[model samples]
Target: MIPLARRAAIGAVLVGSIAAGVLPAGAAQARPLTPATDREVTFTVDGTVTYGTLHLPVHRRGQRMPAVLLLPGSGSTDRNGDQPPALTPHTLAKLADALARDGVASLRFDKYGSGRTGLGAYADKPETIDYPAFVRQADAAYRLLARQPEVDRRAVRLIGHSEGALTALMVAVAAEPRTAGVGLLQPLAERFLDVLARQLHEQLAAAVAAGQMSPEEQRAIGRAVDRAVADLRAHRPIDTSAMPAALAALFQGLGGPSRRYVESIDAVDPASVARRLPPRTPALLTCGTIDPQVPCDTTTPLATALARAHTAGPGRVVLPGVGHDLTDPADPDVLAPAALDALHRFMRCGAPAAR
Candidate 1:
């Protein structure tokens, strides 16, 4: 196995059903694009069969095609890069289709807590889910891609978004020789808790600036965040009862399987991990100015670390006027042109040196 390593859909939800609270319930569901061939596939991990979609180029011209294993972000998100209870645009699906057009095949699977895999993959034990287990899953997916008849084993790649990007980095650190490259889009780059604290503070500050929140409230939230992060670091249960609803939700999301899970990932310094990657491994590090969750300030260190390690490609692929969702700032309805271009280039060639 090349080592690396969703929510069950109710019947036929509209593809647009992914938009979190934005689209009207009556909005039309998106139909699958006809260009690339998509096949439903599965692989076993820890004895549980995992589900995924394999996208292939419409017409393969005699040559073995490159392959990529796509990992979705956090939450109850499915293989399509969607989390129910909110309709998100099909981010991973779009990326996979785009790659198919470029003659690349990709496999995107539902994660443990979401989609078909469900939390059962955790054996009904949420505490079993942590950083290393996630890394192992990605490694398993990489091996699956390698065994594909249409794939070039040596050219298999990884593409991860949000938390998935962090997982991708860990996988890269111990990647097999055949593992080709990695694409990290909007990844958590700093120590996990530190990044979480930064995001919480920024959001609170923004709310205060917008007059939606009081200065006093922001301070209270900040203090709570700091305390919780500190407690998590100490392996203590976080007290969220006094926190604002927003702060409470944030903490609960990050502190999965209890405080220990938070501690496990928080101890991981993403930059430090990047430093351990084989120097010759090519990487595409992307940061969007408007990505509230992974602000440039937080992720820049990881990008710098990659540069320091001489990760192949143009050091940092800066996405100006882009959002955490990969949408264009000017037109939130469309994917950022720069993002699409960068992805196409990266998928085509593991490394495209800086201009």
Candidate 2:
């Protein structure tokens, strides 16, 4: 599931110190360090105009460059991998620049409810939007990227972060033009609700042990959460009357306008999706050891699935002391060099001989 502002709220309720930090101005709004030409592009999906920034490498005469479709994580994250005012890592934008330096083109887009896309046709009916809606939007973007005259249609890849990684798997599984490769960074590895449940249980348990929440209260909240999950999976209404205020609000967020999306994503086990990838697909999976949202261990099953399917590339590269954004925790401005290096190697674009 996409990280949302509500996650901080829930964290505060369950664990007071789990607050999100705001990046300094320099880090939040820094221009791309590497030079690349950027084109603002738009495509229609479900009558919604999707806005994106296509970063193209300097043209080499008679050369059709490899390309990638960059997918941002969940929540209100924009095409640049920023959830404005609080989180502004600009992960995808920097990634595009990196790809440009490697003689590869990349397209990063704003999905519905994000950036310039802003709900569009679903402005008043956001509830109608679900997981498939995002998949459709991404599929359209992939098709658009592949059709670019300067792009090598056969060399187009998909690279996604967090929730976007799961979307990439789904899109690659059914790509029409066929995907050259896939890169998953801090991916969602389990069923969405299962991960949510485990997180809530751990936090609630810790709160009880810390004397922040009573054991009785923890039991009550757990029951309420279980009930809500059941209702969501069964396609019934969630009843939050028995839940505490904070828990109630969180469930309401999960079950209201985003309910359909929650249910749809929850139905998918990412490892299962990985198993369906076409045999021998080039794939790269990476996880940060200190990433609280997606623990490295949780990605083991996904890595195993990909390996069993005979997918190629470095199966899983574990970066120590890195956070969910693939950055050093102490310095959010710079993405971890190891992560970037792994990506560069996977794309196989930076070498002069390759160009």
Candidate 3:
């Protein structure tokens, strides 16, 4: 299992009446490309120059085309779903390629600490970066996508992976002109801290089973984590002085530059957010059986929430052998065909239903 600290760092819905099913092996082929152009774009958010790429289908002219705003997942991930110096899955970029081929436009940007949009005004005071700041950036991106002359404002959709999924939900719930739908890919079905706590517990348990940590040591760390979680949730300062070295380092990192951001995200209940989605809001929830970060079983609450809300689209799809990045486990460099198929179907069928 990946370490707690490392795993902690990395962390959409859509429309229509498509049925959920798994694509057969080798079914990852895409339709022939429509000529498209990629342009570098920039937008301002809270005085920061946010950088992004806008993908437009060239063949479709004189008609507004469907569009999507791709939100990157947690930790230093960039506009193209890559974390430099190591990870380079290119999930979002591939999705943009697929969407353009399908005659759909897309916009993906570098958020705060990543890519060309690095830090910006927050260079001196990184602590000022919080969940709301990310939301504002995404909202700005969505607005830019909607305003583009080539996009149909009413046909714009939001697709986010992992932590970005929460941001997408918040934006979709409050979007003006009413967002057409959302695609929540590899989403968190619970509060941020709750998910963190559960992950820590599982890690600790595994450590004990492996004999790397004694049962007593595991219990001690678990207790410390519980206290720290309570402090974060209550908006109180975390006192990590008494924690084990590993636990202390983890909590200190969370409580330092990103404390406010961590707390803000912790306070959000994803299920509750799902409940607030506008009536008939189309949603597509997906999880991968091979995704260790957000295992398929943990998605129940989010699926349940969407069900109660009466949202449209193919509900909660569980993909086989796919990972959190929506790539096949064996080939992390390429996007999974089944995942792509789901997204294409959603975008194709997500036109706003007649009132």
Candidate with best TM-score: 3
Q: Positional deviation of 29 in candidate 1, in angstroms?
A: 38
lDDT of 3 by residue, 1-355 (tens): 1123543434211221121235554332332334678889999989999999999876534457888999998889999988987988898998888888777889999999999999998989999888889999999999999888878787889999998898999998888657888889998777888888999999999989999989998888888899999998787889786677887898889988999789888889888898888878888888998888899888898988888888888778888888888986667666788897788667756585311
Query: For residues 1-355, could you state the per-residue lDDT of candidate 1 as single tens digits?
Result: 2233223334214443566367775332342333567788887877667888888885433345788889888667788888875867678887887787677889999877778887556766788776676677778887877777777777888889888888888877776645678889888777877876776788889999999989998888788889888877876777787698867887776666645556777778888888887776778878888777877777778888888887787556878988787877777666789888888767656633211
Where does model 2 exceed 4 Å of error? 1-35, 349-355
Ten-residue segment with the worst summed lDDT in candidate 2?
A: 16-25
**TM accuracy, model 2:** 0.86
Say which candidate scores most in lDDT. Answer: 2
Native-referenced Cα lDDT, model 2: 0.86
User: TM-score rank, highest first?
Assistant: 3, 2, 1
Order by lDDT, highest first: 2, 3, 1
- Model 3 global lDDT (CA atoms, 0 to 1): 0.84
CA-lDDT, candidates in order: 0.76, 0.86, 0.84
Q: Estimate each model's TM-score.
A: 0.82, 0.86, 0.87
- Deviation from native of the Cα of residue 212 in model 2, angstroms: 0.6
Angstrom error of the Cα, residue 215, model 1: value is 3.3
Which ten residues in a row are the worst by lDDT in model 3? 11-20
